[model samples]
Target chain A: MSEEHKHTNYMRIFWILLTLTIVEVGMAYTMQSHKALLIVALVTLAFIKAGMVAAYFMHLKLERKTFIAIVCFPLILAVVLVIGLFPDVGFKLGGKHHHKPAASQDSGHAVEHK
Target chain B: MSSVALAAHPPSQEKEILGVSSGKMAMWLFLGSDGMSFMGLIAAYVALRIGNWGIWPDPTKVLAIDLTAINTFILICSSVTMVKAFAASQEGNVGKLKQWLFFTMLGGAIFLGVQVYEYSQLIHHGVKLWDSAGRPAAEWLHPAIQGHSTLFTATFYACTCFHGFHVLSGVVYLAFILIGVMRGRWTVNRIEIVGLYWHFVDLVWIVIFTIIYLF
Candidate 1:
C-alpha cells in the first residue's frame, strides 16, 4: 500500500538473481584453470546477487536512508575486518612462518596439532 | 536554558526510529550482528585455506558443486517466495500470503533436506570434523596434503553446518509466522520483519556456496 512498495518488481529481481546464479555456477566449472580470475568472478557475482536480494526481497531499498546506513555500517566493518586480517593470516606472517619447516619435516607423516 | 529554547525543543514524541518500526529496526540490528558472526567464520575459513594453499584441496573436487548450485537456486527461489509473501501481506490478501509463506517454508525445508543428505554422504566417505591420528585421509583429498585433512574437514563442516542451522531456524521461524497468519494474529509489519530474516539467510548462503563450495 505504501508508495515505496508500489514499483517493486519482485519477479524481475528474481530473474536477475537466477541468471546470475547460473552464470556463477557456469564460471566455477569453466574457469578452473584461471584460479585468480575465477575467485574474482565468483566473489563478484556472489556480492551482486546478495545486493539484489537485500535491496529487493528485504525491502531495504524502500527503507529510509538512515536505516540503510545503519544496516551497511556493520557490513562495511565486516569487509574491512576480513581484508585487514588477510595480510597476517593469508601470508602466514608472525610465527606462522615456522609451520613451513615442521610441515616439510613431516612430509608424508600426519602432523597432529590441537 | 531559556523558556524559548525549551519551547523550541519540546518533549520528543515516541515515534519510530529511522522511519521504521522499532521492531524492524531491532531485527536489522540483530541481523547486522549476526552477519558479523558469519563474517568471522568466513574470515577464519579463508585464512586457513590460504595458509594451507598448496595442500588445500580443490573445493570443487571435495564438494558437490552441481548439487550445491541447485541448492543455491532453491534458496534464491525461497527468497522470492518470501518477498511475495510480504507483498501479499501488504496487499491484505491473506490467502495469497499464506500460500506464498508455505511455499517459502517448503523451499527452506528442501534445502535443509539436501544439506543433510550431503553431510551424510560426506561422513560416509570418511570426511569428519576431526581426523583421527594415523588415519589415512579421505581418498578425495589431494594426495600430498597429509595432515591437513582436519583443517579442510573442520572448516567445511563449520561453515556449511552453521548455514544449514540457519536454514533450519528460518524454516521454523517461517512456520510460526505462517501459523500466526492462519490464526489472523499477525501483522503486515511482522511479515516484513520475518521476510528480512529469510532473505538474509538466503544472502549468507549465496556467499557461502561461492567461497566454500565453488571456490
Candidate 2:
C-alpha cells in the first residue's frame, strides 16, 4: 500500500513540475510588457517548483521539523545577505559622494589600465 | 553485538539528530552551508545587474531560453528517476535501482552536453571571459548585448559554470554508485545519500533558471 501511494505521489509531483515549467516559459513571452509583474510571477512559480522538488524528491516533507529547520536556517542568512546589499545596490544613498557612473569615469580609469 | 542484537537495537530515533542518520544529517548540513555559497554568487550577480540597471543584457535574446527550458525539463525528469531509484532500493529491488540510476546519470550527461553546446554557440557569438575588449566586432551579436558583453558573459559563465561543475560531479558520483550497485557493494542507504546530493543540484538549478534566465 505504501509503495503504491509513493508511486502516485511521485508521478503527480512530476506532472506538476512539468506543468509549472511550461507555464513559466509561456509567461516569458506573454509577460514581457509588465516587467515587474513578470519577475514576481516567475520567482513565485520557481519557488513553488523548488518546494516540490525539496519536499518530495529530497523527502524533506517526510522528515522531522528539526531537519526542516536545519535546511531553512541558512536561507534566512542568505536573505539577510541580499537585503544587506539593497541599500547600495542601485540607488543613491547617503555616502562619501564617490558614486559616479562607470561610463563617465572611463577616461580616468582607462589610463590606469593602459 | 550479533546481527539480531544490532537489528533489535537500531540507533535510538530520538537521539539520532532528529531521527536522521548522522550521515544524512551531515549531508543536510553540508547542503545548508553550500546553499550560502550559491546565494553569494547569485546575490553578487543581482547586485551588479541592478547597478547596471537598464543596460544589462536581455537574456531572452542573448540566452537560449527555449533550449534551456528543455534542459530543465530533462533535469526534472532525472530528479524523478532519482526518487524512483531510491524507492526501488528501499524495496530491495536491485534491478530497478540500477535502471533508474543509469537513467539519472544519463540525464545529467545530457544536461552537460547541452550546456557545452550552448557555450560553444555563445563563444561563436563572441561571449567569453577575461577579455575586457568588450563585445566582438561581429555583426551577428545581439544589439542589446554588444556593449555589455563583458559583464553578461562573465556573470553568465561564473554562475552557470559553477552549477555545471556540480552537474558534472553529480554524474561522476552517480556512475561510481552504479558501479558499486553492480558489484553488490552498495546499500540502499548509500544510494539515498547520493540522491540527496542529486536533488539538491536540481533545486539549485531551479533558482538559477529563474534568476539568471527568466528574470
Top candidate on DockQ is 1
Candidate 2 differs from the real structure by a C-alpha RMSD in angstroms, to one decimal, of 6.1
lDDT digits (tens) for residues B1-215 of candidate 2? 58677665554322367877777888889988888999999888888787776678888878889999999999999999999999999899999999999999999999999999999888776566533556455555645587763577788889999999999999999999999999997766678889999999999998899889886
CA error at residue B85 for candidate 2, angstroms: 0.5
The alpha-carbon RMSD values of the candidates against the true structure, listed in the order shown, are 7.6, 6.1
Query: What are the per-residue Cα lDDT tens digits for candidate 1 across B29-129?
Result: 99999999999999989888876777687777767788888898899989888888888897899999999999999999999989999887776666665
Clashes of each: 0, 0
Query: Which 10-residue span in candidate 1 chain A carries the lowest summed lDDT?
Result: A105-114
| Deviation from native of the Cα of residue B163 in model 1, angstroms | 1.0
* Chain A TM-score values for every predicted structure, listed in order: 0.73, 0.77
lDDT of 2: 0.84
**Candidate 1, which segments miss by more than 4 Å at Cα?**
A1-8, A93-114, B1-15, B130-149
TM-scores, in order shown?
0.85, 0.88
